[model samples]
Target: MAKAFASQGDMSEKKTSFTEIGEGLYAFTAEGDPNSGVIIGDDSVMIIEAQATPRLAQKVIDCVRSVTDKPISHVVLTHYHAVRVLGASAFGADQIIMSDKARAMVVERGQEDWDSEFQRFPRLFEGHESIPGLTWPTTTFSDSMTVYLGKRKVVIKQIGRAHTAGDSVIWVPDQQTMFTGDIVEYHSACYCGDGHYEDWGATLDAVKAYDPQSIAPGRGDALVGRDMVDAALTNTRDFVDSTYNAVKPVAARGGSLKDAWDAVRDACDPKFRDYAIYEHCLPFNVARAYDEARGIDTPRIWTAQRDLEMWEQLQG
Candidate 1:
């Protein structure tokens, strides 16, 4: 391989921040790493997007303890990615929720994803031994489901497919604050390895329709205020658009995958070079875009070996 995956070399711990996006709503963010959301309810708490491993999850648990002592009654997973759902056990919530599609994905490729991600980003899986196995949802919904945390009304809905086939957003009606999983990222690059580029914009539209005043994004900082929320939404849309747009034309012209990679780099580097995890996500994003443009609807499963082969082909 020409070089290691960017994240593989990023072993230094990131500074974590626990910011309150709304009353009783908090976002635990670790720089560009995946984030976790906390919703403090009258009788219990609901956690959204568990981290990569139980060890990493303990950090989110610590943050939750700081603000409330209410027992964690529920954990809502936005997607089935290993980085997002593998830490569910640490929450030990009575109810673990996910979209039906997400649960299916877990059954289909959960192990492969876990292995692939663990190899791609070692730091995120610091406590891999602690992971009992694939995280399964105790409860699932097809389109939408509403959960009342005591008096706080939280709606979990699958707006559309973007980051993955089954992406859900948690909406707090009282505060108009949404906890968007990977469907929305802040400054962090969207990891499109298993994404649907065509449907991503529509998903963003669905999120935009909600007009969330504040958002606990999948990554980056807690989005507070309409301006900040809007900015992150717009920027996330642009990131997805630019990446797919650059690669689609190349694939349409029957260009090689390498060609698509170069095209995406030329189009996205100048604009997004400073974005978090830009380098780590670029190769996979370009490969997926190329596959999508070539009429491949379902993304191919990514195994640990596939990750290395793809990396070597693009970067070596």
Candidate 2:
């Protein structure tokens, strides 16, 4: 398993696809990797979740070119993860929008996260050198904000902290479509290294409240139709809930971190075993769950070295 971290074992690249979930709304998905959302209004364009680097993001831009010529006016980051925000500079949008909480995280751990994430998944950093620096949001909202793309409307809000300190999603009320950054994963693992598990469940409840017809998730494919959208959200909720459920008892009883990890793996791996990144995310997810279960309300920042140390501890 440690070796699994060292190498992805010749996993080939995935073919990218741009699917229209709503009128003039597109989801740029590349199978198991990170996905991006696109919204084209009469006057401009809005992109959700920038890729790892400018060169990598250019691929999404190229796909965008195939559809619309409207200027990319806004780049909205759902959270402050490095892989999701580093490419903001590439779009050169009029405004880089994000939640105020996410901005605070970027200010605190953006650099460490950049290094940590790049080391964990270097393939995503195709044009690392092209990134000017950490992506700083040009505009930030404390909780929610709405902007008009011509007559089209997009509501961006931080529903609650889930995958990160400030997880947000974009809603197109008229289209009944939502762009969820890392808050929802269909066929992918929910990385809980920086997640808030308890709040995450309530957060998923908040997501369901919107009743999105088509949802563009952070990874995996875009969920189309009510059934698929519900399945995605349910899967997300199950994963988060199960993580907490499996680890809480052990943690509350003062079990070792390894014990909690093993318990979670046993409880969750059987169900989510085949999902993308499941193996890679198990250790980190359990660690965070264990902390939260033991009453650690806030998540600890993970550095590259810290990641390795944690992996070694669990693997050893």
Candidate 3:
């Protein structure tokens, strides 16, 4: 290989911020690392997107303790990605929830993803040894499920497919605050290795339809207020569109994956090169974009070996 992944070289600790978006709703963002959300209901709390390891999860627990001593009763996972769900056991929540599709994806390719991600980004898995195993959801819903943390009404719904086939967003009607898993990112690069390019825009529209007053996005800063929310949405849309559009024509003309990668870099670098994990996500993004443009409806599972093979072919 020519070089290591950008994430592999990123060893410095990210400055984490736990910002309150709604009254009791908070977004725990660590610079551009994977983020976790906290929804403090009337009594117990509900957590969204556990970190990569138990050690990382402890950080979230500490933040939760700072505000309220309420026990974490539920952990809501938006997808089955290892980075998002593997630290679930640390939460000790009675009910760990995911969409039916997400749960199925876990059973199908969870271990492979775990290995692939661990190899790609060592920093995220700070305590890999502590990860018990693949995290499984105790409960799942097909389209949408509503859970009440006392008087708080939290709606978990599969708005559309963008980040992953099983992506779900948590909507708080009272505050109009939404917890969009990787479906919506702020300044950070969207990890589209498992993405749905064609369906992404419509999914963004579904999120827009809610007109969330605040959003605890999958990554980057917590978007509070409408203007900031809209800006992030537009930024994310442009990023996703630019990436797919850049690769679509290359694939259409029977160009190789390398060719598509070059094309995407040409189009996206000037605009998004500064985004978090921009380099780390580029190759995987391009490969998936090329596959999607070539009519692959479902993303192929990524194993540790395939990650290296792809990296060597593109980045190497």
Q: Best-fitting candidate, measured by lDDT?
A: 3
lDDT of 2 by residue, 76-151 (tens): 9999998899988889899999899999999899899998887787777877999999999999999899999999
Candidate 1 accuracy as TM-score: 0.99
Per-model CA lDDT versus the true structure: 0.93, 0.89, 0.95
Candidate 3 overall Cα lDDT vs. reference?
A: 0.95
Candidate 1 lDDT over residue span 52-133, tens digit each: 9998899999999999889999999999999998888999899999999999999999999999999888999988899999
Candidate 1 residue runs with Cα over 4 Å from true position: none
- Taking all chains together, each candidate's TM-score versus the true structure is 0.99, 0.97, 0.99
Q: After superposition, which runs of candidate 3 have C-alpha atoms over 4 Å from their true positions?
A: none
Positional deviation of 290 in candidate 1, in angstroms? Answer: 0.3
Q: Cα RMSD for candidate 3?
A: 0.8
Considering summed lDDT, which 10 consecutive residues are worst modelled in model 1? 1-10
